[model samples]
Target: MASTIISKDKFQFTDTIREHLAFGIVLTCLFLFLTSAYTKIEEHDRFMNGLLKVAFISHYAWLISWTVPVAEIVVSLFLIIPKTHKWGLYGFIGLMMVFTIYIGSMLLWSEKLPCHCNLLIEKLSWGEHVVFNLAFVGLAAFALWLIKNNQYKSLIKQNDKY
Candidate 1:
């Protein structure tokens, strides 16, 4: 019985470590996006406008360019706050999905790919962009899994009380 309890505690400790790792991954991603948005706002805006014009979506290009950075900042804030973390993860996933789709589409159909994020990110090849986005998506998915698992475990414990 004592060993069983010790094993249980060890399991919980491991789970906690995983949870913290997920949180750290998410926080790092948040900072990455925020810094990318901040450092290249003008270039990003210009690139978006140019790409949209080329894609024939000129009407909304300006709006999207201006809004994307603000959205990223807001999402970063959400990820930093525990009460808002899940929502932040959702936002992060959505943004990454959109970015991935855009990069994928450009790679698939466009003659030339346009990058407007940051200097470091702009250097990534189109394929690398997809890989990078996918990695963040994986992180977000893992965080979501941890959150759901903890919630489920808590629910089970609550039910066991009766």
Candidate 2:
């Protein structure tokens, strides 16, 4: 039927859109994580000092100074590989959530807020940083949703063919 063909075309168009959007989100997160890791590595001493200024995390600054950048790089690697893209998105979401929570906590409880680890946008206030991180979290989450939805639809299509 014409209606059926039209519906198929519509579905294909939307699926294409979703695929493109997901790809864009993945690339954006990849670039962000890679650049952030590079910046931290380049300014290792200053980054460590900034972490040391934070009252709660000052004790573990030595360990965290190395860990954070390494984790970022690992997540970037995960994002670069097609098979691991889903896990990479998960890692990205988890990292952003942690960063957002840390910033929010600092804003609420810390008497003197230390320099933020976000090398990309140093001028953003703590609140803005939270919002910024949350935005990326939302985008990544949306991309995951789209991917899941497409997989579900594919399964349904396969079932319908049987």
All candidates' TM-scores? 0.82, 0.89
lDDT of 2 by residue, 86-126 (tens): 89999999998988898888999888877745577888888
- On TM-score, the candidate that comes out on top is 2
Residue-wise C-alpha lDDT for candidate 1, range 1-162, written one tens digit per residue? 999998888656355776787788778878887787786575775667565854744578877777878888889999889888888999999988988887787777787555566665777887988998899899898887787787788799899999
Which RMSD values do the candidates have, in order?
Answer: 3.4, 2.9
| Highest lDDT against the true fold, candidate | 2
Please list the C-alpha lDDT of all candidates, in the order they appear: 0.79, 0.88
lDDT of 1: 0.79
